[model samples]
Target: MDPSVIATLTAVVSAVVGGAAGEAGKSAWGSLTALVRRRFGTDAAVTAALEQADTRSPEETTRILVDQAHADAEFERSLADWAGETARLLQYKHDVSNTIGGDARITGTVIQAGDISGSVNLGTPGPPERRG
Candidate 1:
């Protein structure tokens, strides 16, 4: 497996586990976990590991995943493939919103991914003249 894939998975696993472990973050955590389970339920080991992730610290969670990936070549490949697919999907659905108010002006071009599906409202549309 490529090192970058491993690295990306490590970071993602750690972040997801860590966020879900916190009390205040449980709602979003639950959503994230469900998404993972729904997306990658074919692998029993991966499912088991993810189920156990909620109880572990971020670092430990990452360690467990890394160990599993290292020990099982197929698992590693599967994980890397999942991560790439997830990233692509996220990019496809990613949304961005930008606003510029008052006399502020934005210079240069703004690059957006996902084909710029989100909004960029520079200002409100109204009558030409305004008096305070």
Candidate 2:
């Protein structure tokens, strides 16, 4: 199975604020079953998916790593991975190039990270060097 499919599915599965990973755990199985049925015989597919909801099954449980625990982090990582994969898939379509011409430039200076938030602890200050 393509890992990107798992990643996309994982992102969707974890989108809810409070959700369980394996709640409706049939998605992966269903997709696999469909694929096998399309390619091979029903008997092979049936044998492949001997049990629908077996706890010991690695295929059924592997998705949990991406879908449940530390979901935000995992989903973000998965998203980045999938994005890279998609970019690779579309590499031939759009060439990656720097948009700014050699002479083109921004007139204003670029600001650093801590240059925006004002001050959190404003006890001592004199014409601040940086915003935060």
**Among all candidates shown, the one with the greatest TM-score:** 1
Query: Model-by-model lDDT, in order?
Result: 0.58, 0.40
TM-scores for the candidates: 0.45, 0.24
Candidate 1 residue pairs in clash (backbone atoms < 3 Å): none
In model 1, the Cα lDDT at residue 31 comes to 50
Question: Per-residue alpha-carbon lDDT of model 1 for 96-116, expressed as tens digits?
Answer: 445667997778665443364
Worst 10 residues of 2 by lDDT: 15-24
TM-score of the candidate numbered 2? 0.24
**Candidate 1 lDDT (Cα, 0 to 1):** 0.58
Regions more than 4 Å wrong, model 1 = 18-48, 94-132
Model 2, stretches more than 4 Å misplaced?
1-26, 44-50, 53-55, 59-127, 130-132
